[model samples]
Target: MTLHQLRIFWAVAHARSFTKASKVLGLAQPSLSQQISKLEDDVGTQLFNRNRNELELTDAGIFLSRKAELILSSVDETLVGLKEFAEGTRGVIAVGALSSIARILLPRAMHRLSAEFPEVEVDIHETAPAEALELLYGRRLTMAILATDSIASSSVSFHQTEVFSDPYVLAVPRGIDLAQVNDVEADLAEPDRAVVNSTIQFNFGSQHKRRIEAWYQKVLPHYRVIGQTRTYEVALSMVQEGLGVAVVPALTACVGADQSYDVTLYRTSLPDRRLVALTPSQYVRVEPFASCLRHLRETGDDIALPHIEPGPPLMKAL
Candidate 1:
């Protein structure tokens, strides 16, 4: 008859015992029984068959339990919708991104978001760009910051905002001597003479994979990729151990030397990387969504990206 009575009835029906339901509802067993009895009287049917220590829901009880579940779930979802509508500043926003980007960029953006809008919460999912896009399309994430070159064909439509461009950099062991290549530009132009033979590979997708392979053929003809990794940090670490040079996006390299270890950076002439923010078209202009994007662009603009220097192993970037 009442929502409260329905709640009690549903709990007991699921628990299958008056005593168990009483414990779950934190009510006295007799009080719980009385309420259910009152409800059965209102419905003009027996809701439960109570045995000594066991309980069974009658046909009516089973029907009501199913109805209660639907009612409660709908009520909960409605409340969440209303809360989001009224409060543009509060609640959680789910974001998916590459781990390296999440490390370097997300930290700063989250800090700023928290400082400016204390009520909102950011939930970050560290994943590959392609996988992140899948999550975005699936509605698991509201937004994703990643490269979009891998999504070949999909029915999912999303609005992509290019936040920044990242260049490819070779992560070499710090101890390697670059004196062999007198003309740095010429060496990258012809990989046949580039001295570093061992290399580490970071695979994003088939398209990215083929592009990297082409770059290697054009720049490091004699080089052999010793190991394959999914993350730039791992590739950088392998390079630090004197394994081989790793070609990674500057976005990952600029994450700092902690994960990079003893790796030194070298500028490569390969295609520059694209970093984009993909959002559902409907929410792209919405607040907090709009403000979150503003923070991303702000941090991106101020980043001190590293690059290949002419004289040494490090180059300053935008």
Candidate 2:
């Protein structure tokens, strides 16, 4: 009957468990149970079939779940329209992005969003690309910035824009000899045997792991991975000790005297990593989402930077 109850029901249905939904909604489990119980009583039907393995929604619940999504989206759209008409901008826009992307891109993007529409508030949620896409489709997020290849979706209708391409670079210790061996055949013929004996690996998934392994086999021949990490910065630190060469995304592999990553970068034949900004197809017409996306495409390099100038632009989005 009430919007709050319907919202709670939608969350529970999406998550498939009262416990998870309660945590997401920031409410006590007992309170959520009571609210759901009251909602069911008001509706005069049982909404879910609670069992040990999982919380399964009943027939009525399933139908309502789909309808609830449209209802909530329409409500949000109307509110956005009201804010745009009255205040000449939006009220609030929720966005999700991977940590790596967020650290680099959100700074400039949020800066432009605020500069263009002072009253528009943007909420930044740090998440993986897959999770961010889930949030976007669930009507919880307006848009997400994700690597084009990092997307784990098979079939999801959405609109995306290619923002930029980041090259993959080989990170070797400053003392390594590959820095001068630009010719692949020559490097393979007379590589620093010591460099091939020790390698650093940063694998995010099985596919990425295979890709890295394949590249290593092609270039480093019988190379050994001396250290392993999930992040480029850590792998780079290992490279600093002459452990082994690391292949990483260029965005994280950029080198500078002040950057503290004391490694030499070499161009690789590995495919470049492409990044994209995406929104659910339904929200493409939303002004707030469209405007926020413009900030990224227009100032992508500034937004995708790992760090920012001195001052408040570094602050996380509200």
Candidate 3:
């Protein structure tokens, strides 16, 4: 019934192990158990069943766990709001972002926010773009950075700011000879040049795959994609081993010098991809989240976004 008990219950439900919850809460196992026991008694339900080395939530436990998570999250947000109010600063901002943007934008934004508004605590969640939008809609995330091309719903208001634009570029190995060309432009233009056999890697559940498939349909109709992997690093490694050529986002192709393969960047006639910041219409008018969005829009050129666009479509995949 108390916030302390709810916290313990939520942690146990999330971790599915009392011992793990104890470690996370920095409490002894016995103390954690006693607190959970009191909560169960007050609720008049047996929340968990101990089934030979496993903890399973009972029906009532499952029901309470969801409610408890919402309660605790709201309390946490309220406390952050109060703290910010007391300090005379913008309140806390909760942001969700795609993995690609998380790699480059989040770190720099966090650093800048800390320097400029130390009182504002910026919490970031990194996940697929689709999940980030769901969180934003549920009011769990105050804002998000997502792909502009992927935005589907009219209900969710977004302040679109172009963070980075990367043209699709082909990554090929060092020694390969295109039959009819000496340079990138010539290679792209050559009618007799062989289409390099390549494997395309992408996050399995990304919107970017559609764009990529569309690109292939239009340009490389005869070429065979030998493989597909989930991450850019894996795809890049495969390309480095001379497995095949890949069309990757230009930013991700900027690998460090330590990588042992030669990479060639080429211009593609494919449409350029863009990264944008999204938020609810109401939040756009708020102070802290608004300021953060403004800062990102103003300084987007400096941030590097992943080649893949963030977010899932509003309609379910058939």
Candidate 4:
């Protein structure tokens, strides 16, 4: 009956548990149950049926959940529009982005955003692409910025704008110099060769993982995966510690304007990682969100990527 009740029901339906919904909404399970009970009473029908311990939506619940999604999305967009017009861009815009991109680009983008609209505020959520999409669909995030290849093709139905393309480069310990070595197998010493052949792999995005696997197989035929990680920062840090080498986006190894990393970067034949801003089509025409997207693009354009030397011929081929 109320928007609050609809939100609670929506969360419960998505989460499939009153307890989990409570954690997400920051409310008690009893409170959520009470609201859902009141909602079922107002509708004059039971919405959910508990099968064993799991909650399953009834026919009525399925219909209401679909309608609630549309209603809530429209209400949130309208509120954003009205606030921008009434308060002159004095409002918070919740954004979800990968940690590295957030750390490297958001600060400058926000600096520009604040200069233009000093009253505006940004709420950033550092998350992976899947979680970012989840938050975006739940109306907890107004926009999400991430790599276009990070999420499955079927999951990207929202409007997206290309922000920038980051080249994938190989990160090796500072001690191993790739610039002087033409053949990884023949030119490097035994220890350095072992370091080059020992790869630290990433285990997210099926397409990306497959491509990286094939690249390693072709580039280093006898290579072995010594470690795996989900974050680029951790992978690069491991390389800095001489654990193993990794292929990562150039921006991930960069700290602020003048900061540098101990690892060395070498350009590879790998395709560039295209970063994009994803939002509902309606938000594209809305204020503040539109401006924020522009700022993201501008910030990406101005970035000075860390120096990446050309890889050896054997490493660059295939």
Whole-model Cα lDDT per candidate?
0.71, 0.69, 0.63, 0.84
Clashing pairs for predicted structure model 2, backbone only: 105-303
Report how far residue 223 has shifted in candidate 3, in Å.
2.0
Off by over 4 Å in 2: 9-20, 29-65, 88-90, 130-140, 154-158, 179-199, 217-230, 254-260, 280-283, 301-318
Please give, for residues 1-318, the per-residue lDDT of candidate 4 as tens digits. Answer: 999899889878877788767766778989999999999999999999977687999999999987987888788778767786685546777889988888988888999888877888899999878778766655677788888787556445567888888889999999888876767788888899999999998777788889999988888888899998888888998999998899999999887787757899988898899998888766887767788889989988999998888876777556
Residue 179 in candidate 3 has what lDDT?
30
- State the lDDT of candidate 1 residue by residue for 1-318, as single tens digits: 987788788667756677766755668999998999899999999988878778887887778877876665455455555666785536677898888888888888888888877888889999887557555533457788877565434414566777777778777777665635543455444332232667788877787889888876765566677889988888877777776787888777764533335566767766677778887665566556777888888888877776453423222221
Question: Which parts of model 1 are misplaced by more than 4 Å?
Answer: 1-89, 153-156, 179-195, 256-261, 310-318
Q: Which TM-score value belongs to model 3?
A: 0.58
Clashes of each: 3, 1, 3, 0
Model 4 regions lying over 4 Å from their true place: 9-23, 28-66, 153-157, 179-183, 205-207
How does residue 203 of candidate 1 score in lDDT?
Answer: 76
lDDT of 3 by residue, 216-300 (tens): 5545555667888755656767777777767766666644322223555455656776877776555565556666776776556
Cα-based TM-score, every candidate: 0.65, 0.69, 0.58, 0.83
Task: Give one digit per residue, the lDDT tens place, for model 2 in 1-318.
Answer: 898888888877766677877766777889988888999999999999999877889999988877887787678667666666784544677878765567666666778878767877878898766566656645577777877777665314457877667777777677655434433344534345566457888767677889888877766566777788866777877888777778877677544323436667666666888878777555567666677777777766543322311211111111
